[model samples]
Target: MKRAYGLGTRSVAVLLLSVSLAGCGLPRSGPSKSEILAGSVEKLGTTYIVPVDARVARAASKSPELGFSADFVTADVVGSDVIHPGDTLSLVIWENVDDGLLASKGVNATELQELQVDDAGFIFVPYAGRIRASGNTPETLRQAITDKLKEQTPDPQVLVSRAAGDGATVSVLGNTGAQGVFPIERPTRTLSSMLARAGGIAVDPETAQITVTRRGRTGSVWLKDLYRNPRMDIALRGGDVILVEKDTRTFTALGATGGQTRVDFDSPNMTAIEAIAKVGGLNTNLADPKGVFIMRDETPEIASAVLGQAGLRETQRVAYVLDLTQPDGIFNARDFIIRDGDTIYVTEAPYVQWQKTLSVLTGTASSANAITNAAGG
Candidate 1:
């Protein structure tokens, strides 16, 4: 009976050990708060593995297409200050020899005529009749009038100048110090120049995003990029709407790292290394070196390029892994771009799970030993 009891006690200890090991293998009682906040989209269905090289290529390919056409930019630079319909012009007609209409006016062979271009794009000049002036530059209109007056007078000189008009204006809206319709005063008015005229960006320029909407299509560029790259400050069109807004691009940091929160991009070109640094890096004790992941929602084009298929919503959530254990992984992290709305997760190490199981087993063994000691006493 004593031997039987000894076998039962041994069996109980083994059973307890097995139970603790089983608990370790099973998933933890629900995901941690961090996990829920940055839950892996992989659970949704299909998750593609994006390599660092592939991610870099994808990021490089995401340059915003020009919203306005080349013709639009050229027009802004060339004809921005040109008089259009609804513009009033001060016209002075002078003749070297007093003759024709100015001579009849009896004013030293010169006449000052204030004329406004009609909606039909014509300005009525006495004796010169109706002249199309809407699309013509002031110098071009002056030449046109001179050519017409040559039929009646000798060497008639004409000066056409803009008196008043709804000058070339762009709507400057959103997070700007002053929001209103800012006139494009100069023919060479560029995006940066316009922003300056509108009191510059109200928010931090590093954290500001600029979007230009022309006609109906929209394109965006980082305000920081515009500051760094002068070429990106394209000329602003007359009707273009320039929106200077706070950067809404954010990524969630989760798992064995700093606190989980949606971290905003300080700049548009944020890499995985930068993102990790933003979140205080990984938890040294619990983080899995091989489990650094950046989860992103892929566009259909990206999904097709990476996963070989599209249409499946599940396939759109891609997980890009960067294993710090590999020698090249750190280098890859520097190149792997972290896109807007990505989730950065550093999973717990497998050894950490084993350690938890060991703790449970140690506690169970201590309890069993105490029971045995009490029974013996």
Candidate 2:
């Protein structure tokens, strides 16, 4: 009985040892309370922190004009509507009408006159002559032609058609794969369609802004606005010009990260997490969790003065710092977003710089030894 009892005791001890080792090998079930709190704090600091472009944000958020819903369409197409430049007009004469009566029967407008309206908004016709074609839709232009023909012949038949030209042409230029004029064939041209025509705004889209300049209109449309609301996909009228402005958002990043990098945000509303991913994720062994800063202009005083009249305050102008070290802080790291023109920097732990220097030295020494041996041979 004594030996049996001793064996039982040893068996229990062995089982306890196995359990201890298992705990060491298995992953933790969840983060501790402190980690959760840290993550929450970090996330709160990041989401509200935007870049220094209040002017741009304000401009983008402004309410669009009422009754001008980009989606809205009217059934009645008018004269001031039809055949503008950039519109393709199709002209068809009645088969019953003798060719003697219609001077230009069976002749295509494009073949005859290129069907282009000059900057002065007039298209040269064979008989109708240089008539003001701007703001007139096909039906209205046809009616105008009918009225003109009435003076020469009684009960004249006339047909006006919109061919491929004189509709809407948007110019996509600068850093685009295909930099040229893209004709907006449809009545309403969305921002997405325009980019497609321009070979999709170059690769990565970081350094691109679609600038829309109307021929006679004074104001231009911001490409970023389309991001906020697809409705900002403004309709393209005749002689509209589009510019794919080059990328301007750029910043330098350094410290415990994999490598110092220069990144581009292109435009606004690219969050912190996004910017970090662009430069490569944090170096697990080298990154120090506590140090991250987005550098911006120290122009709060200027911003406040400008906004003071408009009832904006200084408390609104501040950048954010994100801490990643504490396990709980990971939540904030994920939630905190960045905006356009914002820079993200992650600091490396003190030991990483020394390790990197040693790595370089070792590589150099190995190369030197290899070269010396090769020369001896």
Candidate 3:
């Protein structure tokens, strides 16, 4: 019966090993590469898996981002002497006679400093009836004042200049070297000049966004684009609000990468290779070089172009595959762009699971050996 007893003991040991492995649960970060492929079958899962190539990279790189529209880019440049209500004006008046009605006492020229424009756009000048100043340039206002005063004094000379006032100023705020209300002066009439006058953007130029809000409409563009594309520097108007802020675009890293977290875009036009490096590369011990995937929700047009198909009616779920083991894999990844809201996942190597299985088997065998030794003793 010794032979029968030995077989029974071996059967028990095998049963225990099976139970132990089942209890361990495999301990995985995410689904394996095989599982991902199997899950993508028709009617089984929703993710459309597409391998990354030069063509796909080109198609996916055209992502929509924040930028100014034609309305903002085509707006005319503001003139320094443009008048507005609440604006301050300085005026000088002269007459053929030594002392005129608007002239200073004992002075041939009358100096009117800090003349405020009323809400109705009118400014009252001594001996010159109230005149509309808003919607007119300093020269135009000068002519109006001259015509009005000429009836009272012959050969009247009038000069009008805009002074620093609550009107015709831009509120510069957020991530700027200096944040406050900046006047729209001669050098600070356009967007670029106004930003410079506010001490420029305090954030990185690559991630900085310059936003302008005018009459309830808003437009934004990268700070670098402002300098590169001159058309983006539109004129600033009175009561216009300007904001400089860091980019809020981000992508998530999951699975076997260095850190499973959301990472912000630190540069413009981020690529898959740059994203990998930003997340601390990959976990060398667990990462599968051939299973790097970037998942994104692409529009129907872009999806059709990437898949070489047409008539995609809705937003398509796309998983872009990358195999770093191939000769051109690194190059392919370098060219593949990573957009905001994408998820990067690197599967664990297959052998890593096998290693765990072997460890479990060896540990069980060692436990059996110890039991046998104890029984013999």
Identify the leading candidate in terms of lDDT: 3
Q: Could you tell me which 10 consecutive residues in candidate 3 have the lowest summed lDDT?
A: 15-24
The total of clashing pairs for model 3 equals: 0
Go through the candidates in order and give the clash count of each: 0, 43, 0
The C-alpha stretches of model 3 lying farther than 4 A from their native spots are: 1-16, 19-24, 41-43, 94-99, 103-109, 154-157, 164-167
What lDDT score goes with residue 148 in model 3?
90
Cα distance off (Å), candidate 1, residue 256 = 0.8
Tell me the deviation in Å of residue 226 in model 3. Answer: 1.3
TM-score per candidate: 0.69, 0.51, 0.90
Worst 10 residues of 1 by lDDT: 28-37
lDDT of 3 by residue, 14-118 (tens): 758665674347788898888887767254788788888777788888877767878777778778888989999999888888766866567778889999999
Candidate 2: how many backbone clashes?
43
Please write out the lDDT profile of model 1 over residues 1-377, one tens digit for every residue.
68657855975777576665664364542233234335444455356565556455455235333233454445435355477777777888887764456665445455556688888878987778899988888898899889988898877888887653554568989998799886666533788888888887889887788888877967677786777766677777667899988878788998888667889888767888888988888888878778787777777766676655556454366777777878878877887777777888787877776777777667666767666666655
- Estimate the overall C-alpha local distance difference test score of candidate 1: 0.72
lDDT-wise, the better of 1 and 2 is 1
Query: What TM-score, to 2 decimals, does candidate 1 have?
Result: 0.69
Per-residue alpha-carbon lDDT of model 2 for 1-377, expressed as tens digits?
A: 66655555555555455445543343332222233335432466422233223342332222222222322222122223355654545555442334534555553222333466767777765566787777787677778876775676566566665554545555666656687766655533655566766676664453445655554433333455555665555555546666666646566666545557787664454555556666777778866566565544324443344334354333343334566555645555545444444455565554554565555455545555555455445
lDDT of 3 at 374: 58
lDDT score, candidate 2, position 254: 60
